[model samples]
Target: MADEENRKAVLARVHGKVQGVWYRGWTVDTASRLGLAGWVRNRGDGTVEALFAGPADAVDRMLEACRRGPSAAVSYTQLTL
Candidate 1:
């Protein structure tokens, strides 16, 4: 659909118990599954940082997924849209 092609982007910094919690790897997998194109990395200030660029819906889904995180990865995410 045309809507799926509409690109969107967001730079998110997820905080709280995110660092050293495999958050970056979880983000990468989640993003990939959502068909998003971006990268994730850990910040020195105890956060997980990522840039998600893709179809608008997919990007949105990725953000939501990041909030819940992947299984037992204690993360309280705070992202900026």
Candidate 2:
């Protein structure tokens, strides 16, 4: 699995206005559309935690989109990529 070996993985924590918003849904949709694989969930520290695995470029794009989260995210979202 050369592709798997070359795949990139990241555990990202998103902060600010992420909880109670459609961030998870948006993330699932976006990640799936980007052909990435990952799992996202709400953390006790009021942050969104996610593990993304895919091409490096796609992962970077996902991280960028996370920074500019869904419109539902009231406050500014800061994605810790």
Candidate 3:
């Protein structure tokens, strides 16, 4: 498939009080809901890193969701495609 047609990968580094705040779980849930394939993990630096591979639009939406994560989270960054 053409590069543009192929699924894109989104690498995100979320900051603020993200760790231990259900950020990863929220990411997993949101990605799953959007039919995305990837994983979210807690970083040693108190950040949350996630990789989302799927349609560009879905990935973008997921990133936007990351910007305003769950009630316990305070998103500070979202590096996208």
Candidate 4:
């Protein structure tokens, strides 16, 4: 497959007690560990936002993890590209 086809970009918005719960830190660490290139930040609406670009499978794994989130987080909504 082509490099572009093997890569993907994901935008995730996590909700339900995600803020002030180390969500961003966990996301950053996970992304780094997965060799993803992107960033995670807090939104003004009490949500955590992240952009992840990496191998398709790795990105998908990360997205799955985001759905459950850390112990403190409750839920997540993701958009993939």
Give the best candidate by lDDT. 3
RMSD of each: 2.2, 2.5, 2.0, 1.5
lDDT of each: 0.82, 0.85, 0.88, 0.86
In terms of lDDT, model 3 sits at: 0.88
Ranking by lDDT: 3, 4, 2, 1
- In model 2, which residue pairs have backbone atoms overlapping below 3 Å? none
TM-score of each: 0.84, 0.84, 0.88, 0.89
Kindly list the per-residue Cα lDDT of model 4 for residues 40-75, writing each as its tens digit: 889899988899898999999999999888888887
Question: Which is the better candidate, 2 or 3, if ranked by TM-score?
Answer: 3
Ranking by TM-score: 4, 3, 1, 2
Q: Summing lDDT over every window of 10 consecutive residues in candidate 4, give the lowest-scoring window.
A: 72-81
Candidate 4: the clashing residue pairs are: none
Q: Tell me how candidate 1 scores on lDDT.
A: 0.82
lDDT of 2 by residue, 36-72 (tens): 9989999898899888889988988888888888988
Q: What tens digits encode model 3's per-residue C-alpha lDDT throughout 1-81?
A: 765696689899999999878888888999999999998889899989999999888988998899999999988766855
Query: Which 10-residue window in model 3 sums to the lowest lDDT?
Result: 1-10
| Reference-based lDDT, residue 7, model 2 | 78
TM-score of candidate 4 against the unseen true structure: 0.89
